[model samples]
Target: MTVDVDFHHGDTIDAVFPEADVRVQVGFAAPYAAAVNYGSDPHWPPLTPMVRWTNKLGWENYDLQEADSEDALWQKVDNRRAAGDPLPGAYHLAAHIAENGTKPMLYASDAFIEASQRGEKWLEGRGYDAETPVVEIARDFANWSLELANDNLVSRVSAASDGNLQRSAFPAKVIAK
Candidate 1:
């Protein structure tokens, strides 16, 4: 199994988590804005560039629940695909992060999972594999845990345990895949 450490803006995760597993993946989430001026208008939309940074860093997956709309989410994914970038999902992320080119990790919110299970269809509508696993965390970082395991095909990790560590080890067979 592969491990991923999530860091929020202004939070230095590296300082808190042990670095014993250098092979463990690291990713950042949250919004950040940059000031820019558009052509002749002298005004620019505030753009948070975390998605682009994730693409550049080859992060396995990104959670877009903060996006205001499905269209906005598609724009980011489409832009990345058009640019020939890597945009992985839960299953893919874990595979990628594994030493054997397995998927890495999934980053999401509780709402996302609930929505998917309810057949919201937005994720599938946006070209994501509906079967992908997700790591759902709380918006406030209060409680965290993993859910949705079927025959050990997919696993989720949430911030349920102290220090946001995964309480259960990922199944060994899943990693071998």
Candidate 2:
């Protein structure tokens, strides 16, 4: 099982679980401010400790790379945070699943769940939480038939005709709650 940690302007939970092919989890970190300029920008922040640990255990490519300009990237981050957009990465992942009708095993921690709940509440307050057919279409990828493992670690395994879990490993105890 490969583990990856992505950071952006949104709420997300953290937890561990085992599914069809691997064990995974998601979590959050302190709000990070993208450096305003490159030369002086802090070294691109390191991947979350969880991700690092996971990589050490052989999980790779957990962090997706975005090759946008610093200014552009920060602008997007600001806009999403201000607009309370779902984590763009998550959105992209969801879209990938939808388009391909493949489900990927996902694990998140309680913190990540809380963050998602907060984001949902914010959307609800803005009247943007209504279910829409487009959303159904976008979320359809979730139905592609991949196994889902949650906090319990019970290892709920399932099969996805179209998707497969990327295999990687994590160090023992990558993050603390």
| Best model per lDDT | 1
Model 1 stretches astray by more than 4 angstroms: 1-65, 88-156, 159-177
Can you write out model 1's per-residue Cα lDDT over 18-60, one digit (the tens) per residue? 2312222311222210111011222222222333333434445
How many clashes show up in model 2?
Answer: 13
| Top candidate, metric TM-score | 1
TM-score of each: 0.19, 0.17
Error of 1 at 13 (Å): 49
The regions of model 2 sitting more than 4 angstroms off are: 1-65, 90-177
Candidate 1 local accuracy as lDDT? Answer: 0.31
Q: After superposition, how far is residue 70 of candidate 1 from its true place, in Å?
A: 2.4
